[model samples]
Target chain A: MLHFKAEIKENIPVSKNHYLLTFTPLAKTPVPLPGQFYMIGIGNSCDPLLKRPFSILTKSDDSIRILYRIKGKGTTLMKEMKTGTVINVMGPLGNSYPIPKKKHTPLIIAGGIGIASVFYLAEKLKGKAIVLYGARGKHELLMLDELRGLVKELHISTDDGSYGKKGTIIDLLNEFHVNDKHLIYACGPKGMIRAVSEFALEKGLKGYISLEENMACGIGACMGCAVKTLKGYKRVCKEGPVFNIKDILW
Target chain B: MNLEVSIGKLRLKNPVMTASGTFGYGEEYSDFVDLNSLGAVVVKGISLTPMQGNPPPRICETPCGMLNAIGLQNVGLKKFLKEKLPYIRNFDTKLIVNILGSTVNEYVRLASALDEARVDGIELNVSCPNVKKGGIAFCADSRTLGRLVSKVRKSVNHSTLIVKLSPNVTDIKEPAKAAEEAGADAVSLINTITAMAVDLKTRKPVLKNITGGLSGPAVKPIALRMVWEVSRTVNIPVIGMGGIMNAEDALEFMLAGATAVAVGTANFINPSSTSDILEGIKIYMKENKINDISEIIGGLLIDNPDD
Candidate 1:
């Protein structure tokens, strides 16, 4: 991993309380894979202290994009950033999503801001995957047009019934026909991911789920962002941000 | 022009060392930092057996700092000697292993084993606040600290024995003096301060451990004060650390009578913090026309009316 200052290319509001930030690295960095993340420094000050972790939303030769919600001090500060603002970035960290077997069909599930973690994976699937995207309302369903254009099939839901089939993403999953031939990839709140984990297990479907936690050193040194699993506690910044669905204890 | 400093008989090429629990095994940061540039690399706190650490939500960012309750998770002494030791031996820097244990025998065993392997230093971690046993217990009382240090000192023949003191105590000088009298070569202070954070929405503690050791720029002033106090109380060299983020902070520790300084939380913020601080120190020395880094040790000047 490399740590260098990157100049912001764009910071645009995508949906309610959500934004897409793109930056060009001042130094050459390894290509980041889907499901991998970068720790973005907030400001040039120590008040916010630790760098915030963001998943790679998209990447090109010159710039990389990350979708974030203004939920805390770090993101709020990030939203005010304009083009040409240089910020420290350490990246292409953690493991990437595994490719589905040739015989298996890819099924991607995302909830609310969790869409940021899987958007790059959808792009990699190259129109071969089916996506189930959900949010609190239609305004929070970010980058719908772009996601639809990339995937072979796209389904959406909102808790407030302001958009596609009302209710949780788990409710929408109940109507879908899933089996061992379908490979599931998910990222969402703990409740949604837990429900999806159980659903995938019941159907005997193999899958991977991206996890999130408050982290200190984005490297393995701090051991701060640990998540319990069948084998043992794993660092979310190192051992994962993505894990085999069957491996998670909860 | 000289940056060399001695901790007991161990001579470091410079006074900048990576704090224990922050630098890992020296390999995790090899890609971002040149281990050869560091004066010393103090690995994470190791125990007799591998520890799993605390549960999730082990850390939370606070104002100007962060709280971590990692519970001293380590690969155990066996793994360190077999796997970690060999990898770090490739680097030109001195290696100091930070050891933790539940009893005096455990500490003695870890010290002798590491000394037998010929590591450069052994830092006794008696102030890690996250664990339930062995850590803060030994250092809470000066008497107990003295006994522990004396026993560990006996087992350590080749390596330097540095007792890492706790800031949670009433007076930091007691343990520093005790460690010195008990044959410790040097003393490092302060470990993270005991602190906590709460979530209003959930009405619960932010960390599953409820409380964690506070470190970062927030604790720097307190650490500096404690280092100054202990440095005056003890004859042995003082290794100062706690939220040392930049060269200015590291230099401040030296002015407060610290012979050497360790970079801890700054490593998490910037992986190359130790190297950066070392380079900054050199620049500071050159700009001020200071020839030796030792000149800055205990350099703080307090005007006296009598003078």
Candidate 2:
């Protein structure tokens, strides 16, 4: 619900093409909950006209962190910014991950830059959760030091054998003995999330999945990010960026 | 500073309104902006029956705009009347519902159902293809657009009718003229221009629908030109929209001929865009010492002389 220029406190390169940017608000704002996102307007031109959506990676007392990968022109512009750059950001948008009422083990699933929101979700969960993170290689795994202290358990998978188990993260599912009793919160590429969602359904596990789609208004105004479900189409920017796996129609 | 503007019988508090499909019922961005501060709110396009719409990837960002083939996906009449309308009725701004249908009867059905409700106006969508029209949009032909507008106007007598014209047509003025002649109170343009994009690496269409409507700042110039042309062709008021991101952009359209302006794709960049544009317009009016906004409407001065 805010749009202002935030000064980049630090723009750290986490890995190849991936970056972790932290910014301090020039103005006061409310704290963003985990899974919430911001629409970042790139530069001052119209070439990358649409503000790219980025999830909250983590937040401190005064700074908001965003984790991103250089996938296209938008991110390419982001990667070139220096530490003192001021960027236009509008935020705390869409629904946040709901705090579970019932007592159940939290199983965090992250794929690549999908790891953006998990750190905050884990902090809220507070060392009561287990993390399953997947990347292409060792260098792709980000913020391992920050995550290790916040979670009770951590599992890793790399597509290339240069890191952990050399396969998709879905291959590492059995180690957790995942079931209806465990809660699964996943974010990743569609194929990976789909496989995890199907596996979760098959095991009768319950959790939410944060989806990504090309969008216009990150708010519900533009129906650009509609995701199909049993009910019908829902806006990924409003009704979710996080939705119950049981409700989504793959 | 008399910001009031009108379209037929409906008078707005200001000339600022959010374009349909961009503001999504007002409440979505209510947290970011005050809904009562604007002139009006045009909700997303609604249909007679429920629509599944086109599949994902529904949108792709182009140079300065984005292309989307949402296929006018929306809650049906029953759900909207039961669920959405009541919630929207509570907001302070004028409520204009943009409606779409595959056929003439479907349009009538939707109009009749929404008639006499708390809604203020209905925007008929003739931009997209109809099943009965064999893939041609009604607005593509003046005759068909006139027939559809007249019939819908007859069926729904309670609210003002605004015809939203598509920009893809070769001559936008013809459709605007047809709507004006067929009892439409006003006309709004331009609906997204038909466009498409591709993924060079994957060698596939960027949007699953293959082609979509292009909208955003990229379409502003073209939209301004069309709004000017339509304003000259039609006798009724014109609600201009395209890539109106700020007050200056809105002012350009007003001077061109649009009595009112709607912020479309710009809403995505800032949820408070409508009010921001409203504030911008007020600032401009103050800076120029203008007392009334109507004086600027259709008042663009051109230096080119007739041949």
Residue A53 lDDT in candidate 1: 96
Name model 1 segments beyond 4 Å from true.
none
Q: TM-score of predicted model 1?
A: 0.99
lDDT of 2 by residue, A57-148 (tens): 88899999999999999999888888989988888778888876567888999998889977789988989888999988998898889999
The segments of candidate 2 whose C-alpha lies over 4 angstroms from its true place after superposition are: A100-103, B129-136, B304-307
Chain B TM-scores, listed for every candidate in order, come to 0.99, 0.96
Cα lDDT of model 2 overall? 0.86
Docking category for candidate 2? medium
Clash pairs detected, candidate 2: A221-B22
Pick the lDDT winner: 1
* Residue lDDT tens for model 1, B24-80: 899999998999988899999899889988887899999999999998878898998
CA-only RMSD, every prediction = 0.9, 2.3
Can you give the lDDT of residue B270 in candidate 2?
A: 73
- Each model's TM-score? 0.99, 0.94
lDDT, candidate 2, B202-261, per-residue tens: 999998888888888999999999999999888899999999988999999999999999
